[model samples]
Target: MKPKILDRAIVGASLLGILISTYALNVEMAIQAKPEYKAFCDIAEYLSCSKVLSSEFAKGFGLLPNESALKIPNCIYGIIFYCLCIFLSSFDKLNVIRALFGLALCTIPMCLYLAYLLAFVLHDFCVVCVSTYIINGVLTFLIYKKMKVLSAKKTC
Candidate 1:
């Protein structure tokens, strides 16, 4: 695929990631304000987004200590990540594309850990969480493709 096309695809995926992460953040805040609130993504007992979002793991990626100062919600991190991706995708420099590809690649381990938590610990399916994971995967692939195309042009 062409680098320009791949960059556009990356932007598209980042936009989707932002939208879903924003929705998840809103849901998280709503749940905090009203404990009894029901999110639209809370489909069923086994597939409850609220259940997963409300868990302790949902905050700080469940990787930080309780007393840590950076205990922001995971959704916030997702929003920041997607936004950064959008910014990086706008650049045509090879180094910028490499950085973007590396950034997207780094999210995989976090996604795997969260997916494991959702399945084993939380025992619930979160629509927002799964959607973000898919978006990240897509973004990574698109960025990698773009990086390869750019590298090939320089080589030729």
Candidate 2:
């Protein structure tokens, strides 16, 4: 019994996330080609997308020993995560909404952790990264609302 408006909102947020992540990914690739490339989001020394994307944590995990493989940007994960959210939200079933709720619950912590890393460890914040965080927050709120509506439907 998820509201159609809520579903559309979720999809809209997910699409925004995907778009930002794709831009970040392109920036990442551009940086790889020309190490001196400065992203448009590189506002200041302490607020640079290139600095954050070039950092050690930009990869899957800080543990990978191979430098080349570590070049993979974390925005790839964002794209996948948001795409999954969009796919789940497209379904009208209550079970799908519940699944999206669970996914959102899991992503909230990861988003917080990434924010912490950006603020503390990296001492930098990418505009694209912050945008994705905001998108995630919106998606989480929409998913929670949809879940509540579904639960009330079940009870009544």
Candidate 3:
């Protein structure tokens, strides 16, 4: 596909993924605080924010899980994704490479965290957790490809 078309699709998908995962995270948070979203709470049972969100380990690598730190990993990434989507979809679109770089830059840490969770903590994964993983993985690839093309063009 043409790079522009491909990029628009990627940006759109990333925005959707961010929105969905934000909802899932909020659902998980709800499960942590209350029992309201019973169905969502039920599916995210394996995630157990009680364990993942409120534990010493959630802090990660000697870093404490404060508002900014947590926001950096989960919250800001979503906002960045949304803003990137809006920016690209608007008249002055970003180059595919720049978008891809931004995307991978946002998502790689998440991929690391998810992998860590898989390897050490959560023996089994939640459906939402797995979906988030897949979405991040795809975003990483899409951005990587776009960046590669862009860089190649610059060299040529």
Question: Which candidate number would show the highest lDDT if scored against the true structure?
Answer: 1
lDDT of 1 by residue, 1-156 (tens): 877788778888888898999999999999999999999998999999998888999899988999998998998999999999989988888999899889989999999999999999989889899999999888888888889888998889
Native-structure RMSD, model 2? 2.3
Model 3: pairs clashing at backbone N, Cα or C within 3 Å: none
lDDT of 1 at 84: 96
Q: Candidate 1, TM-score vs. the true structure?
A: 0.97
Across 29-135, the per-residue lDDT of candidate 3 in tens digits comes to 66567754363434355654333433333333225445544533343445566566545544322374575467556666766776686557665455554555676
**Once superposed on the true structure, which residue ranges of model 1 sit more than 4 Å away at CA?**
none
Please report the candidate that would top TM-score against the real structure.
1
Would you list the C-alpha lDDT of every candidate in the order shown?
0.90, 0.83, 0.56
The C-alpha local distance difference test score for the whole of candidate 1 amounts to: 0.90
- What TM-score would each prediction reach against the true structure? 0.97, 0.90, 0.63
Model 3's lDDT to the true fold?
0.56
Question: What's the C-alpha lDDT at position 28 in model 2?
Answer: 79
**Who is ahead in lDDT, 1 or 2?**
1
Give me the displacement of residue 134 in model 3, in angstroms: 1.4
